[model samples]
Each structure stands twice: as structure tokens, then as C-alpha cells.
Target chain A: MSSSSQINKRRTKPAEVRIDELMSAAQTLFLEKGVEATTISEIIARAGVAKGTFYHYFESKQHIIEALKKQYIEFFIGVLDNAVRQCAADDWVSQFKVWIATNVQTYLETYPVHDIVFGVHHHERKNSEKNMMLEQLLQILVGGEQAGIWSLGQARLTALLIYCGVHGVADEAIANQLENTADFSEQIALQYLKMLGHGELNK
Target chain B: MSSSSQINKRRTKPAEVRIDELMSAAQTLFLEKGVEATTISEIIARAGVAKGTFYHYFESKQHIIEALKKQYIEFFIGVLDNAVRQCAADDWVSQFKVWIATNVQTYLETYPVHDIVFGVHHHERKNSEKNMMLEQLLQILVGGEQAGIWSLGQARLTALLIYCGVHGVADEAIANQLENTADFSEQIALQYLKMLGHGELNK
Candidate 1:
């Protein structure tokens, strides 16, 4: 690698800084006015970066999306893994409930902007990141089963079911489906936690 | 009203019949030609309906979607109610499993077109039908609680959990998110049944 390239990368104020600024600007503009409406020129203008810098960082909107999606998925996986890590020593079922609750909080907390990540956003927007996170959840469930904590015959399927309610509620929240959003999500998540923890819902 | 109008009303097929025909045509077109690529004219042509007749029966693609959604939710509710009725006298949990397995078959065999119902096509659609069915599920759950058949403290939330998993599996299946579709869903439902039936993952 060139010394100048390494030096610039380490500098973090000029070249590296501009990329972050551009990404933030693009995300803000894209969220405020959808992907179709936002343009590279506008994103560059917002970031106060020259057009060349934008090109240096991202070749096209598609390229920007690729970068953004990678980052977004990485962030999502981190959140889930963090949840998993928090309950590493607990009963698998209890830990599973905690994981589910985190997903709900992830949705409610993310709200309008971050909600897209919670849905069936299998678009180019989400791919490997989602699959990896899903696999991690499966691993948790499988661990539960192997330890005899969870007696599910199908770990993957169980993971899907266990995660399903959380996903649906989150999706509903994302879609603004409930008449009673606050109460409904709380009730839904609580119920799911109970059901997943115990076969019967008692929360 | 004229005699012709009276005759037409009597001779008119159930809105459901036309709706099914429309759905059949639409699904075929949607698969052969993507959802966005397919045109209203193509749908009408496939349905053998006139331009005005299409409007008479439905306002737009969204309207057709509305009708299809109502039917889908109703069908699911009908299945659940039937399951509850059959198992109301038996173990509520077992009955629920049988009902889910039955629906899983139905999902694979019959309504392979449930992607739209699962919130993927939300631009012109609303979540009202989905919630309405949820309310119905809650009613049955309330009955189970009253009779001490089910121990869900918050029935609505509990129902949300079960529904999210099973329904979400079907959603994934319809959304083509799973491999080995048939085995995947039923296995999960049964695992869920065991988990819900007995507190532990074990029987």
C-alpha cells in the first residue's frame, strides 16, 4: 500500500472524514426523501463535499446503497449479538425471550426510519447481514436444544416461530398496523415472551 | 329498479367467485410477469372482464387486493375456529397444533399466494383485515382463559406470539424464505406445540 494512502486513511480528518460525512448526508436525504428522489449532487451538496470526493467514495447510487446496506446489516447483527452476549449464562429459553424483547425494542426504538430493517426488506438493501443474524438466532435456539433446555425437534423452525411473532409485531409497528400501538406492542411482546419461555402465555 | 337489474342481482355470482377468478388470473400474470410489470389491462384480459366491469367489481389493483385480503383473513379465522371447535373438547394445545399443521398444508397446497397478505404489498393495502382476524383469535383465547384451558395472562399478546411465528413461517414460505418448505413449517409448528404444551422444550 502507498504510504500516502495509509497516511490519509489514518488521518481520519480529511479523506476518511469526508466519506463519513457523505454517508450521513446520503442516509439523511434518502430517509427524508426516498431513494428515488435523492440525487448524488444533492447528497454531495448536503455533505459539502466536492463531486469528485463523492465519486471517490461511491461510484453510483447503487454503489452507495451497497455500502449503506453492508453497514446497516452489520449494525443489526451487532445489536442481536449484543443481546445474545448479555444472557450467555442464562437458561436458553429465558435468554431467547430476552433476545425477542430486544428485537421488539429494536423495532419500536428504531421507529419510522429504522423500521425498514425489521420488515421483509429482502431487497438489495438486506442480504448476507440478515441471513447471518438469522443464523445466529438459529444457533441460540440450537444451543438451547442441544443443552436440553429447549426440546424443540427442529431448531431452525423453532427459531423462525420464536422470532415470527416478534417480527410480525415489529413489522406491524413499522407498518403502523395497530390502533393501540403502545399497548398492543407491549402486550404482543409480553405475550410472545411468555409463550416462547413457557408453552402457555402467562405474562 | 328494473327487472333487468333484479335479474342481474340474482344471477350475479358471489363477489367471492369473481374475486377468486380475478385472483387466479392475477397470480398467474404476477408470476409470469412481475407485479409491477403486469398491467390492469392484462388482469382484465385474463379475467375475461370488460374495462368498465373491472371497475364495477373493483376500483383498482388495490381494491382487488383489499378483497383478497379480507378473504384470506376470513379463511384463516375459519380454519382456527374450526380447529378450536374440534379441539375445544380435547387438549387446546394439541388442537392448535393440528390446526397449524392443517393450515401449513393449506398454505403449501392451496393459498401459495399468501405473500401479498403477509404485509409485503402494503402500498395500497391496510393492516385492518390482519388486525380484525387477530381480534377474533383473541376472542377464542379469552374463552380458553376463562375456561382455564389456556393460561395466557395476556391473551391478546400470547396470541400475537403464536400467530407471529406460525403466520410468519407461512409468510416466509409465501415470501419464499425457506428451503424444504413443507417440512420446515410443520416441524416448527410441532416444536412450538411441545414448547407451548409443556413449559420446557421437553415433553
Candidate 2:
């Protein structure tokens, strides 16, 4: 074939790359115009993929959002896991602090997608994803309790409080548009640690 | 006029009573069938009021939800206020405890209505109603600080944490289908108090 004809041939990108392109395009559009406003055709157009290719991956626009939601949750939990792993296995204090701090930082950074996914789902009495995150947090609380760093009389309840409390305050921080979330995250960590009767309060 | 004729004369209820009837009926319907499923005609029919009465009180379904939301917030804050008032004026600790206890108690008691009114509102960047409730909690925190029950370095943030933490745990309690929320509420209050460096954790 001539050089020009060769250049015009369809380039076969990997399935993962194409899926990423579609998801990235969908995320951008969803964030820009909202989930309700964006459509599948727009996503396919934005992704520069054929309709068949789009269908090969996601069943619908909502399916893309579901995929994004799963990615977002995994991304968030992964961040916490990495933060916690930075400390020694026995140093549950650091693990707990890093968990809270990373949680605040990552959530503030990623809440737009968070809002897009979670905001649409109404008051779900039972959210498995939330429960999974709580399980991760409980590990930190229970680990600390076992190590004698603090007494967690009600470990699961305490985890729920800390997990929800962190998320709630992060929402507040986002609302106020605080410039430095790290300091606020640290403040939250210390306060929760104090609640756990592990860390000393600031004088 | 004959006695039967006089008794049959259309008994015009007071405006306050009429408005209460309309709101009560609307609340019940909204809870039973959800906001979208409940209709203005049903509300009027349930209230035994003419269509004009509902129109006079609320412009639309959304308008009724707004009214119900305001009433719900007031009812909630009122419960906390009454609980706090039961203690001595100078006893900020009791005031604070009552505030948390009443908050958890009232939230668990009334979350269905709360969800109905609030479930549809998107993740708001700023919620004035939430701010108002936070202000009420701040009073107790600052009051206790002035009384020297415990030092609150970051009183506003502390209040936010405590407020969010309490709500979060109550949600957990509800999710777990706990029969008695009092013990859980007390547990939450004591953990927060420990965070405040005032209450002792269970041994």
C-alpha cells in the first residue's frame, strides 16, 4: 500500500486503552454537564470511538457511571491502603492518622466524581461500598486496640463514627473551600484520636 | 334555625388548624408514597380541605417539601433545646450531653421524614439548614468552654466533628437495626466527650 493509504488505515488500540478513553471522556462530560445532561452518543463522540466499540464496553451511560463509581471507590480505598501501609504494621497510630489524613485529602480531591456517582443514589439504607470502606477503617481501629495504642470499647461503632465523621468534615471543608486541607485533615485525625483516647488534645 | 341545621353549618376551622391539617396530611402521604408519588389532590383530600387551601399554603409539591423541611428542622432543634433546658442554666456539660443525646434520639425517631424532605436535594456545597443546626451545637460547645468543663481549642471544628460523628453513628445504628439507640447515643456522646478530653472512656 502507498504511504498515504497506510496512514489512513484504522489503528487497532488495545481494548483497555479504548475502555480508558471512553471512561475518561465520559468522566469529563459527566463532570462538565452533569450525568443527566450527558448522553451516550456524546460520550462515544468524545471518546472518538464507534458506537459498536462503545457498546462493546458499557451497556449505557448509567453503566459507565457505575464503572466510574467502582473505579472511584477502588481509587479511594487504594489511597488509604497505601497511606496506612507507609507506617509500620504495629504503629497503628500512624496508620490511623494516615488513614484519616489520606481520606480527607483524596475525598476533597475527588468529590466531584464522588458527587456525580453517590449524589444520584438516594438515601440507601444499606450501601455495600460504604460498608467495605468501614471494614478497612475497622482494621485500623482494631489493630490499634490490639496493640494497646488505645482502648476501642466498641470498635465497629468507633470505626463508623470516625469514617463518617471524616467524610462529613471533608464535606464541610469543601463547602468552605479551605485552601489547605492537610492541616484540616490533621486536625480531624488528632480529634478522632483523642476520641479514641489515644492522642493528647492540643492545649 | 333548627338545631340540626345549625350543627350542619360548614364549620370553618381556624387558619392555623387548617394549615396544620394540610401539613400533617402532606407529611403522612409523603412518607407513605414518597414525594413524587404523593399528589396535591391526595393531600387536599386527606386533609379534608378544599384545593384552594393547599394552594394558599403551598405553591406546589416542592413548596410543601420546603415547608415540611423547615418544620422538621425546627422540631429537631426544639427537641434539643427542650432537653438542654431541663438541666441547670450554668451546667453546660449537661447541656452538651443533652444536645448530643437529643440529636441522636430525634434523628433516629424522625429520619424517614428527614429523608423525604432532604433526599432529593443534590449534594449541596452549602446548606443553610445544616449551618443553623451546627450553630445550635456550637452554643453548647462554646458554653462548656467558657464554663471550663473542657478546653476546646478549635471549637467550631470540634462541633462539626461531633455533629457529623453523631449523625453518622446514628445512621449506622439504623442500618444495623438496633432496637435501642440510647446506649449507642450515649456511647457516641462519651466518645466525643473523650475527644473533648472531659469524659472518661469505659475501662
Per-candidate TM-score, first chain only? 0.76, 0.88
- Per candidate, chain B TM-score? 0.68, 0.87
Model 2 residue runs over 4 Å out of place are A1-15, A200-203, B1-14, B200-203
lDDT of 1 at A66: 66
For all candidates, state DockQ relative to the true structure: 0.32, 0.57
What's the DockQ of model 2? 0.57
Native interface contact recovery, all models: 0.44, 0.73
DockQ of 1: 0.32
- Candidate 2: tens digits of C-alpha lDDT, residues A1-203: 57754564556776678889999999999999999999999999999999999998889888888988888898888888988898999988888888888888888888899998888785776788788899999988888787777888788878888887788888889888876877888888888888887864222
Which structure among the candidates has the greatest lDDT? 2
Worst 10 residues of 2 chain B by lDDT: B5-14
TM-score of chain B of 2: 0.87
